[model samples]
Target: MLLSACSSAERGPVIPFFGAYFPSWIACSLIGVFGAVIIRLLFIKAGIDAVMPLRVIVYLFLAIAIGLLSSILLFGR
Candidate 1:
């Protein structure tokens, strides 16, 4: 499969000095913020319920936190 081939490629080891974990956190935060904003705007424009925006944001944050924590615990210094 394509996925298997990609995994076989020689990706270098993770570099901790770059705050490798930080980028994941930042990306998660940005996605949560932007996604929430866009969803709220769309809901308002369409005159629908506003609760979905909050739920989406919360799920995004949770997912990101879980991923970051797992990575740190698995590859910590």
Candidate 2:
């Protein structure tokens, strides 16, 4: 029963919409930049003094790292 459950839990392929037009490296980098811009803008507009620009950059870097790692593991040659 445990083995059956584990097998059943395995996921099928995920189909990306609009197809995989962009390469993972470029896609991840652009997404990171956009996310950083949004975060910085929101923090500034909200007057959140504690949320520095560096924090946004750090968050962006982490996001990009995760994305790149996932791409390499899941789609690399």
Give the clashing residue pairs of candidate 1, or none: none
lDDT of 2: 0.61
Where's the lowest-lDDT run of ten residues in candidate 1? 20-29
Q: State candidate 2's TM-score.
A: 0.41
TM-scores for every candidate against the unseen true structure: 0.37, 0.41
lDDT of 2 by residue, 1-77 (tens): 65785584654434465865444566656555666577657767898736556674577676676666655666562
Query: How many Å off is the CA of 8 in candidate 1?
Result: 21
Per-residue error for 7 in candidate 1, Å, reads 22
- Best by the lDDT measure: 2
lDDT scores in order:
0.55, 0.61
Query: Root-mean-square deviation of each candidate, in angstroms?
Result: 10.7, 9.2
Please identify model 2 stretches exceeding 4 Å from their true place: 1-22, 49-77
Error of 1 at 24 (Å): 0.6
Query: In model 2, where is the ten-residue run with the lowest total lDDT?
Result: 8-17
